[model samples]
Target chain A: AQSVTQLDSHVSVSEGTPVLLRCNYSSSYSPSLFWYVQHPNKGLQLLLKYTSAATLVKGINGFEAEFKKSETSFHLTKPSAHMSDAAEYFCVVSVFNDYKLSFGAGTTVTVRA
Target chain B: GAGVSQSPRYKVAKRGQDVALRCDPISGHVSLFWYQQALGQGPEFLTYFQNEAQLDKSGLPSDRFFAERPEGSVSTLKIQRTQQEDSAVYLCASYWREDNNEQFFGPGTRLTVL
Candidate 1:
């Protein structure tokens, strides 16, 4: 079984400030990691993915995540927060390229003006 | 290019009522998936379909749930005897077997079982 843990339920940051959302994963075997963003009443949008190609992965909207195998963490970070970034984010994992996705509880982001 | 689309963006059903949700995947996408997202929680996989074939449905909560993709493009998920616990947003995503493993998603159908 594979699962992901989002360390924060809600994160509030000021505009133009760096944003950080923590996530960790546990899997019995090799897995693929993904970060998806969901605006209110919207579908999940892929932010970035880690297929073991690079330790550090960059995504759209100035967001990025690092795959730390030893720490079992894949934390998402953005150089600057945008008001539009206020939404829910999920950390997902699929065991060994399996299509089935196991998502984290989700972290709600709030960007203050 | 159109992404995945779901009908009845919002649905309200009384307990014991049956509901059917539709999903129209991106053209040429060979795989489709269903997921359920409860309030304050992330989405959970419900089933998977490849073309007109259902390869796996292990995530379906119970026999009350049924899905089909007869023509290999449009798919439907049917829930019988809906209960209060079934109130959630039903999400549909489609993927192409080739290229990256990314799945395009739809806005989803929010089912409220009152």
Candidate 2:
């Protein structure tokens, strides 16, 4: 079985401040991890993915996450927060056994000026 | 050049009514996927198709949900006798190949069952 856990249900940050959204995963095999963002009523957009090639993955909009095998964690981070960054972020893990992807509940991010 | 597209951006149905949602994948895409997203929740996988073959439907919540892609280009998801619990956004996504990890998602159809 594969599953993802996002530590925060909601995160509020002031503009220009550092942003962090924590996520952890559990999988039996070597997993492919991903981070996606969804704006208000929009569809999901891929932020980045770690397919075992690189432990440090860079994504769109200056966002990035480090895959730590020892910690079982893939946490997204951004140096500075922008108002447009306000959205829901989901951490996902793809099962190597069957190619099915599992998503975490999600973390809602709020950016304040 | 266009991404995945879904029709009936919003649908309001009374309980027990049937509804059909459509999805048009990107040109030449070989894999299509359907997912359901409840309010404030992440999208849950519903089914998957490779070309015209329905490879997986294990994530479907119940038998009431049926999906098909006859010609391998356009697909439809039909929900029969919809219940209030069926109210949610139905999302469609597609990838160039089954082995590809990146998927392009559509805006989705918001289904509301009263």
Off by over 4 Å in 1: none
Task: Name the TM-score of chain A in model 1.
Answer: 0.98
Top lDDT prediction, candidate number: 1
lDDT minimum window of 10 residues, candidate 2 chain B: B96-105
- Per-residue lDDT for A41-105 in model 1, tens only? 89999999998799999999899999999999999999999999999999999876588999999
Worst 10 residues of 1 chain B by lDDT: B95-104
lDDT of each: 0.95, 0.93
- Candidate 1 local lDDT, residue A22: 100
Candidate 2, residue B93: Cα displacement in angstroms equals 0.7
Q: How well is candidate 1 docked (DockQ)?
A: 0.72
Q: Give the runs in model 2 whose Cα sits over 4 Å from its true position.
A: none
Residues B14-106 of candidate 2: C-alpha lDDT, one tens digit per residue: 999999999999999988999999998888999999899999999999999999999998999999999999999999999885556888889
Clashes, model 2: 0
- Going through the candidates in order, state the TM-score of chain A alone for each one: 0.98, 0.97
